[model samples]
Target: MVTALRGVSERAEAWLDVERERIGLWLPVALGAGIAAWFALPAMIQWIGLLFLLAAGALVGVLAGWQRRLGRIAAVGSAVMAAGLLLIWARASWVAAPVLAQPAVTAFSAEVEAVEPQPAREQVRLIVRPLRRPDLPPRVRLTLRGDGDGIAPGAFVGLRARLMPPPTASLPGGYDFAQRAWFDRIGAVGTVLGDVVRSPGARRGSQPLRARLSAHIHAQVAGSPGGIAAALVTGDRGAISPEDDEAMRRAGLAHLLSISGLHVTAVIGFAMLVAMRLFALSRRLALAGYVLPIAAAAGALAGAGYTWLAGAEVPTLRSLIAALLVLVAFLMGREALTLRLVAAGALIVLLWRPESLAGPSFQLSFAAVTAIVALHESPMMRRFLARRDEALPLRWGRALAGLLITGLVVELALAPIALFHFHKAGLYGALANVVAIPLTTFVIMPMEAAGLLFDSVGLGTPFWWVADHALRLLIALAHAVADTPGAVATMPSFPRWGFALTVGGGLWILIWRTRWRWAGAVPLAIGIAALLAQPRPDLLITGDGRNIAAAVPGGGYALLRNRAGDFVRDTMSEAAGIDAPLGALADLDHVECNADFCRWRQGAEEGVTRAGQGIARGEQDAAARVILASRGRDRIEGAEMAAACAAADVVISDRWLPRECAGRWLTIDRDSLAQSGGLAIYFGERPRVVAALRAGDEHPWRQPDQLSGNDEAVPTDALAP
Candidate 1:
């Protein structure tokens, strides 16, 4: 046994020596791990967190004194990770802006900071800084009337509106907009109550330019194609119809519309290509040793401009920083699109906007690039893509193969993240992207650029027409693919632990450079299995406590609501993987349901399995009774309420119980549920609960008190954070 262990250690050392270059790539991973660690914690005392970081620094100092090669690597790697974790924690504290605690109606005078006009809807989104509310954060997002004319950035305006805290997750593991809002310093979000009384000069800020450009593009193009074009150029996505957007998402082409890394890379690449070509035309300039530098400078400038044009959102800014790093790498004569560049960009972005680390854009962007770089660096791929004077047909075949490989790699690399955030993954996204990417990158983008060039001479109509047609073709293809049966697969639930496992496995595989990398597949397999293993919740409650979904005795889930809008239905469907329409609670077979309560009968069928598993053998013949209440009524007679409580498993009313009501196993009332934002309850031997807002969570944006308000409508587009 001692000899075998020694042999293994020797072999590992040899492998490490051979793969020394790859070790540097893990530094960024360490940093990201640190940042992720910070976000993972619910709440930490500031001084305690700082002390932990200091301890980490001390660990690094002590570890660095070790003489062993492996010890050195561990010290450096762990130090990077600790730095990342502490850096993110510090950033959070630094940017801890004020957030509204609850929904409140008030009239306040404000200055228009920015105006985002939705030409399609003939409405506008006003970013304002309220003058009267000194306690409010610097910015608030409000939906208002009109085409957003007459309000400049500096123009003061007065308005009466009801402000609400940014929306939290509607269900456990659902989207959380409050986090993003907090990072953006948006104190409150709401719709303008009535007419806006403004000083009314002219709407200023970056929006006016972007809105005009978007409108111009829409005019040149038409329909959804025009919307796509405008989004591609100006990053104004409001013009795209919901149907088209859904199709894009289903087809896995939604990335194109987001003005992210791909668009930034393309713009920078094109700018560099143009500058290099112009310089190459002059032999003297090419020989002066300034050609590459000039080209890099041009690419950097274009990337920055494009980022600003795209609203300068964190995602766009992340891409810009990454692209700039690539340019810098090129100027320094290093490999431009390598893993190091990706890491550097990620580090810079994390330092600038640590909160973005939690967002899908940041995760997907970095993961995809890191995986792609690793793949291309492999010996087999390097040999495959090696340049040679080959036949045109062979070259085309090689390019096609590379594209397919890249798409599949990116798909696999990003699948866990996509599944974690969206609960869904595209089935044929690689196949669809094989066609869409080339069109967008080679044909559509170039045509759009040419149109802008020709428009300088007032002759760009034909180019714009060509670009519009190409965009339409892309949309048509997306629809065809999205509408196909089984184009998308959704998981009913995915726990954060599963996501962590998969991500760690992926990083292990990407960062290692030996047969040992294959070992990552073990955890990857386990994580994927875990994703499909989470039990579907038996009950779901909206944040407002106004709606409820309960699994029936038979098979299907039923809802208790006067009207379940498309948004609510879709949100529930996505979260639970219930494709069938939600049935009326009172209509389910063998279940006793009324306006105030529901009871799921035991053994309604031979056996009802969930997620392919049955309940525990802890025997019980009693039915599961879930009591619900309404808005108008809070309490009932003491004896009647006591009997109702005694007969069931849990009570989900808004805590309107009488004094004698005491027999229920558990009571989840409005105020208690409010602290959680929302929740999912799994009916079992002992009901398991998952809160949308985890316990001890004390993020700046979180105000659990705000989640308990009454008269809350089912959240929809109008109330979007």
Candidate 2:
């Protein structure tokens, strides 16, 4: 055993000796891990062991300085990890804002922070700051049911609005908007009740500029083409029809609409190229060694300006930072693109907004960039993918091949994240990107830029006309690709554990430069297996307790009611991994549903039960039935709830059931739904629930959690309830 252990140690040291160069690349990864750790905590505490860890890390770092190789690496990693935790803790504290406790209707004058004008509907969304109540939160989002005329960012307006705490997930395994709202410092979200009373104020901000530019683009190009152009240029996507947006998503070209790395790179690269060329025209400037830095500065300035115009959203800001880093590296006479640069970008983003670590934007963007950089860093891939001087046809073929390969690589890298967030992954993104990337890079963007430039001179019509036609081709391409068979792979939910394993394994593969990196395939394969084997929920309930969906024996879901809006249906569909509409419960086989309730007979015979966690196989047969009460609280009585609860294996209710009413296995009602946020019911010999929000969840923005834990509840209790 000793001999074997020594041999292993020697081998590890050898591997470390060779792979040590890659250590620096993982600093940002360490930081991100810390940020993720902060978010994973159920509740905040006094530094959450930050001080001890920091001190311990410092001690290790100091000792490691006295040692060599592996010790030094551990020291650096530990130190940075601790620093990352500190940075996030500080960020969270700095951005922490009061959360709205209950619903309220009050008239108040407030300064508008942002405005999103939707042409499709009369309603407009605005983020505002209430001027008066010391008890009120600083920021609230209001959706006014009107044309929202004469209201712009920086305008002060007095109006009566119904304000409530931001919503949690609409259903289990769905996005949590409240967490995002917390970071954005938006405490309340509601609708305006009365007409707006606009007050005069200087309207100057990115929204005004973005609104005007977006409107101008919309005027120049009509319909979907104009919508796409406007979104690309100004990041105002209200103009894009839902049909076209969905097509873009399905085609895997939706990134075009978001001002991300590609757009940022294009703007900066073009600016740099132009600046360099202009500087080269002056021989004195070129000879004075000022060309590269000056061009880089110009590129950075242009990128910053574009980012500002794009609303400085997380993704745009991240891309701009990464681009600036590249420019900085280039001017310093170092390799511009590297994993270290990706790390720096990630570190900056995390430090700026620690909560962004939980968001798809940060994860997806950073993951994509990291994978791309690692690919380029590999000597084998570099040799294989390197562009060479050759015949024009050969060069074009190689370039196309490279684009396809990069797209495939990025697609694979992002698949887990996509699945975790959206319950689906685009399968044909690589094939679509092969055409879309160049189309956006060479044709559409140039024409659009020219159109914008010429619009100022009042001669942009022809350019916009050309852009419109080119966009038509792009949209057509997106539709054709989206309609292709097996365009996307779907699953109901990729569990957090599986997602962690996959991302961890992927990072291992990407970060390590040694052949041992192949070991990551083991965890990656295991995570994929877990994702595939994950059991589907037999039933799902919306947060509001108004809608319920049960799994059909064969496939898809049976809805208790069809009157639910598209949003609810869509949310359920995504969570159920069914791309089509959910059918009515009454239409399903062996199911009886009425105005009051729906009963479905399903169990072992129909493979409704899994082996573990719930009722085991063969424990029950098709004779078993699950019932859900369809009536609202005011309409349903306690006796009826008890009877339904007793008659079924699982009981779900739209009304609040008395404490005495408990089903055979599980009973869920409006009261429980309020506590759980939403629920995923798994029917088996022993039915179980997966809740979006857990009991005692004390996150500040999780409604009554923070309020109930303090005296804050008194006012909220008296005011709204």
Which predicted model would earn the best lDDT?
A: 2
- What TM-scores do the predictions have? 0.89, 0.91
RMSD of each: 5.1, 4.8
List residue ranges in candidate 2 displaced over 4 A.
1-6, 43-66, 200-207, 387-389, 603-623, 632-634, 703-721
Error of 1 at 333 (Å): 3.6
lDDT (tens digit, per residue) of candidate 2 on 210-311: 888888888889887888898888788876777788888887788889899999999988899999999999999999988888988999999999999988
Quantify all predictions' global Cα lDDT against the true fold: 0.75, 0.78
Candidate 1 structure lDDT: 0.75
Pick out the ten consecutive residues of candidate 2 with the lowest summed lDDT.
Answer: 708-717
Model 1 steric clash pairs: 34-85, 151-202, 151-203, 152-202, 152-203, 152-204, 153-204
Stretches of model 1 off by over 4 angstroms after superposition: 1-12, 45-65, 119-122, 149-152, 200-207, 388-390, 552-556, 591-635, 703-721
